[model samples]
Target chain A: MLAALAFVAGWPLARTIWFGFTDASLGSLADAEWVGFANYLEWFDYGDGEGEWFGLLADAAWWEAVRNTLFFALVTVSIETALGMVVALVLNARFPLRGLVRAGVLVPWAIPTIVSAKMWAWMLNDQFGIINDLGVRLGLLAAPVAWVASADTALIAVMIVDIWKTTPFMALLILAGLQMIPEDIYEAARIDGVNPLLVFWKVTLPLVAPAILVAIVFRALDALRVFDIVYVLTPNNASTTTMSVFAQQNLFQFDQFAYGSAASTALFLVIGLVTLGYLRLARLDLGN
Target chain B: MRRAVGLAKRIGFWALVALILFVSLFPFYYAILTSLETGTAIFEPNYFPEVFDLRNYAQVLGQGSFPRNVLNSILVATATVAISLFLGVTAAFALARIPFRGRKLLLLTVLSVSMFPQIAVLAGLFEMMRFLGLYNTLGSLILSYLIFTLPFTVWVLTTFMRDLPIEIEEAAIVDGAGPWDIVRRVFLPLMGPALAATGLLAFIQAWNEFLFALTFVASNETRTVPVAIALISGASSQETPWGPIMAASVIVTAPLIVLVMIFQRRIAAGLTTGGVKG
Candidate 1:
């Protein structure tokens, strides 16, 4: 029964994957055309006169979306993982008002992503924003800058907001992992004259490897699928278009239903591959 | 020398922790600070709070769709939690405790579904919503949001269910208890924490959901907090009002913060234990 309920819950996912291979369109299901491999074929198009797969493979825009999505995922996940680990280490230590501070740290995580994006968008506004005020005051820049208007800074601004909101989640997960490490291991390491760094590298690292992998893998998958932040922050800004945003653009905004489904199917494949890699690294025995 | 090193580590740790907290909180604090300051007061050229006023909060709360949206969000999230939990717990119990063929394949399917991208289903889901005559309704968003929450609830609850001792359940069976009775009497009480944790996860996921809500609901009555604030485009070509947005943002965030603050340890344990495989 539990499995059934889970299945019902996940039926939408199956519906998504199944429909991706079809020529489903905005029209009714009766009007749905079955076009096997046609959607996938469109993913590789290069806009050539040949109208063949050869031309499709050279599509720069598709490649750019892939590159941008992967780059964003890699940078954001790596930075958040590193910073989150540091936060975990620091917060793991006993201190005054520790509980209070621990709870306070979740403020960012609790804020909705859209609201966070909008708030940061306001702060990063070029003209009357306080970020420019502070940046100029602190001598970080010679003049006030509009952070979201330019291609160079648009992606970075989105990344900054995401990092701000999600790093606490990373920290919280790592902190939970940290707490599970018995204090005696560190004591033994200290008694053996192991420096904290070596103790971390040898003792803590191996012990916490599974948890860290889980956190990073989850965060990475989520980051790769990022849509809401980029969509709300830089809608139609082309430069900040991640794969999901690109898919949405093709589907809803542009009304290119087939093309959008193709892009979404590609994203599914990429995420599926990542999830496979994660399962392998974490040794999660799906018991296949 | 040893004492000095220990003291330094403590101080260093506290300072670093404080710095992290500040950076984590600065934007929200600044938002609330800016919201409290009158429009011109924000131009005073400093990060400090100038004159505190409730005008922004009042304006957003009383004069906009924010309060109504909050109620809509609460209703949608609460309904989502109830329905997902009921179905998820039942399914989890069946999967975890019941002996049935194809269970392994079923479990794998559940896991895969849980991880599949929502976008993959977006077009189909949108079509389904329209077909079912649920488009632009709270029911539409609630059902759609389940695509994310249900698999998680079932997966996490199964894990929790699997960990519970079966001997007590068997003893109850010896007392001639039926499956429903066993679930109600023997298991439900024992699974309180698991249920609470899963329900909390479901609620938060629903509350913070944006994409489906954005796509599915097209009316003010159905818009959730995230979508409401996200799509808060001002009238005409005027800019987004940061003060009201922040005020609304703060209002929506306050409850979640309180939830985390009260359930800090439980939530942390829930996330780590729920996600990580042994």
Candidate 2:
């Protein structure tokens, strides 16, 4: 029964891997052409009459998508981690309405990603957006800016929405880690006349390092494979496209199923490496 | 003097923390603000509304496919939660107590599978869904969602099951209770918190899922809340009715917020435990 259950959990994923290397259309199973590495190679330019090595190197679109993905992951995850730890540490401290505050923080997280993206998109509209209105009124800008319409602001706009939607999740996880540290340990440090900064660095940081790593790993993996926010926020725009968006465009919008599968397979490996890195770093011991 | 200094530092730390929380929640506040405003008022280059109207909700709820989407979302999410928990709890018991061979390898493989990005399997799953004639059905969406939810559920529940006392289960077994009986009478009551937490996690994940739902379900009748709200912004290419879209976003998100509020502590505990298991 356990084996059967595990099989159910894993069979679809294994099938996914198999489909990546084949030119399988969604329309039929009998038409799958076994094209080994053709899809992967096609990640580089495979245009008609193209030279081999130079053409591959000149695939700027794929590189731009890669760059945008990495930039999104790096910026959003770093900001979220710093801000989340602070929120976690604060929630760890005693206060009235602590439960309410904690719950309030999770509201964005619980809100569907697509919903929040739409909400942010509406708020950032150039003509009637509250953000633009506030920006002009507060002297932040001279005129309404098309935050999601243009390439320059589209990526940043998407990042802000992503960070707003996910920081609560990071904070909650880190807060759990913060609570796991014994109060007596901190009290002991205080008795030794340790400064606040030293106590946090020497005592809290090292002890909570595992949780922080876990949080980053999970967030990074999700961010690397992000799709819905960018898709909903900036459709029909090239500037804000991440790898997932690019792959999705091929899969759904363009019906390039084989190529999209290959792209998704590449993403799987990137995230798999990160997960393995975290498992080693955290010395994560699973099993009875 | 030292006590005074300590008190001041604590106050400052809390204030800083409160500031972060405020920033984190500011967009949601803005969402509610925009949702409550009239389109004419919102387009007037005004940051604050002079008058509030619930007309956006009335308009969106009455016409814009919100109600049908909500019903579809609830049905899909509830079914996903139920199926994931049922399978996960049973499998977790077998792993935690059965002393079976390959248990360790199986656990590791399940964890790794849980970590694998869903997109990697998108094309394959899509093909399979099409093959099985389940494409664009809520059933297909639920099954695809199980790929992520089940493994994590089993893993997390295994951790929780391990923490339960062994003697209680052993005694039940000695009394000639079968596996089903032992699970029902001995463990089910004890698993309320774990079940609730895991079920809630699975529900929220299914509720918030977008990519698969977007790719698979093309019609408005089968579309979930996330997809509904997402497509709402495109009343036209040149004109998006912000008031109705924001209103729909809020209405769709309200239930999720309630779920989080009621189960905040359990959700936090479950998340930490799942992380540890991973």
Question: Each candidate's TM vs. the true structure?
Answer: 0.91, 0.91
Best by lDDT: 2
lDDT of 1 at B218: 88
| TM-score, prediction 2 | 0.91
DockQ of 1: 0.52
Which 10-residue span in candidate 1 chain B carries the lowest summed lDDT? B269-278
lDDT of 1 at B181: 96
Question: Model 1 lDDT vs. the true structure?
Answer: 0.79
Q: Which regions of candidate 2 are displaced past 4 Å?
A: A1-9, A25-29, A42-58, A277-288, B1-11, B45-49, B233-235, B276-278
Output the lDDT of residue A214, model 2. Answer: 81
lDDT of 1 by residue, A1-288 (tens): 444444334454555556556656655444666666665654444567444452113556677778888989998998999998888887788867888887888778877888788878878888777789889988998998879989999889988988888888888788878888999998888888988788888888777766777788778878888988998898888688888887777767776666677777789889989888777855654443
Query: Candidate 2 on A188-288: residue-level lDDT in tens?
Result: 98899999899999999989877888899888888898888898989877788888887777777777676667677677777877777766756644321
Clash pairs, model 1 backbone: A1-B91, A2-B91, A2-B92, A44-A56, A45-A56, A46-A56
- Per-residue lDDT of model 2, residues B66-179, tens digit only: 899999999999998898898898888999998979999989777767666767777767777777898889988888787778878988899999999999988988999999
